[model samples]
Target: MGDEQIDAAALQSWLRAFARSVAEHKATLTALDAEIGDADHGANMDRGMTAVVAELDATEPGTTPAALLKKAGMTLVRTVGGASGPLYGTLFLRMAPAAGTADSVDAGTFAKALGAGVEGVVARGKAELEDKTMIDALTPAVEALEAGLAAGDSLQEALRAASAAADAGRDATIPLVARKGRASYLGERSIGHQDPGATSAALLVAAAASTLGVVVGG
Candidate 1:
């Protein structure tokens, strides 16, 4: 997939897909939040994405991948509060460097760039997989992308694998006791509840797969 093949339209479409998915699942996301954080992750993310959609429409940032991501990052930082704000902000900020001026990225480049974003989250939050955080879902998704690429899979196939891995990772968090973030404060109480971050992270990956036309597994 050359740069010409993946244009600004595709990037904007991805963002729109993400915003729509999150908004559609706001109640479910909030329910997950009720088990962990301030029970506002869904509402906060919805608010932030709503602003992003508005910005995209108002600015019409066509074909400028870096600028679009930067705009999205700034919106999240301003609209979302608590850990999600800074963490997600950093993810998109780091991703902007990789996206550069391209209209769309190829499979390998997109996977590597996404890995960079996930690494930023790990560094910013100091969380690891199975720590009952978003890391669990995101890490597996990145790894799956890398693996798919190594096997010479198509971008859509790779993303489908990534989304499935993310879902599995999210489910795996159910029985684990939280070892990081506010959920950690619950001690054993966190054992029965799914991590909100992990749930949202899975949704993020699912959004990616959907936007890219990947046939994600159940």
Candidate 2:
């Protein structure tokens, strides 16, 4: 497969879509959190993405993927407080190196870049899948991306599969006991609650699908 073409306008549109989705689902996310967290995951992400969208609009970084991601990472780091800020910031920061020069990336390149981002998150948070953290969602999403690429899928197909995998991973978190982060403090009490990080990670993958014009399926 060849490198998928994405332009500055597409990237900008994706960011805007992300911000809108987070805002629209704010209550749902916070409600999921009220069961296990501080009930601020949605609010925090909404605020952070709002800032990111503003920066994207004001700066108009064009098709420089690296610069755009870097700016987004910095914005998240500065605006989003908590473990999420650092973790997500690191994910984008790590991805910048791979996405830096190209206006578009092929499925294989995107998969590799996303894998790097997931590794950064793992290293920063010291968390793993089934630990009731974002790793649950992100790991499976990246894996699915790899699988899709290996199968010679188009970038859109890969993104759609990745998004579906992420959603499933997010749902799976509900049955696992927390072993990291604030939720871990609850021990077995965390078993029935959804992981806020996983929820947000799923949102990220979903945003990717929407931006890339992938028709996601259940």
Backbone collisions counted per model: 1, 0
Per-residue alpha-carbon lDDT of model 1 for 1-218, expressed as tens digits?
Answer: 21123445655777888889889989998898887767888898888888888988877645476777788888988989788887887777778888767666666667777888899999999998789998999999999988987887777778889999999999999999999888788898888888888888898898888776443461
TM-scores for candidates 1 onward, in order: 0.92, 0.93
Q: List the residue pairs that clash in candidate 2.
A: none
lDDT value, residue 150 of candidate 2: 83
Candidate 1 colliding pairs: 6-104
- Model 1 accuracy (lDDT, Cα): 0.81
Which residue runs of candidate 1 sit more than 4 Å off their true CA positions? 1-5, 213-218
TM-score of decoy 2: 0.93
Question: Per-residue CA lDDT of candidate 2, range 1-218, in tens?
Answer: 42566555656777788888889989988888888878888989889999999898787544477777788888999999988899988888888797759776655766787799899999999997799999999999999988887887877788889999999999999999999888888899998888888988898889888887443451
Estimate candidate 2's alpha-carbon lDDT, on a 0 to 1 scale: 0.83
Candidate 1 vs. true structure, TM-score: 0.92
lDDT of 2 at 206: 91
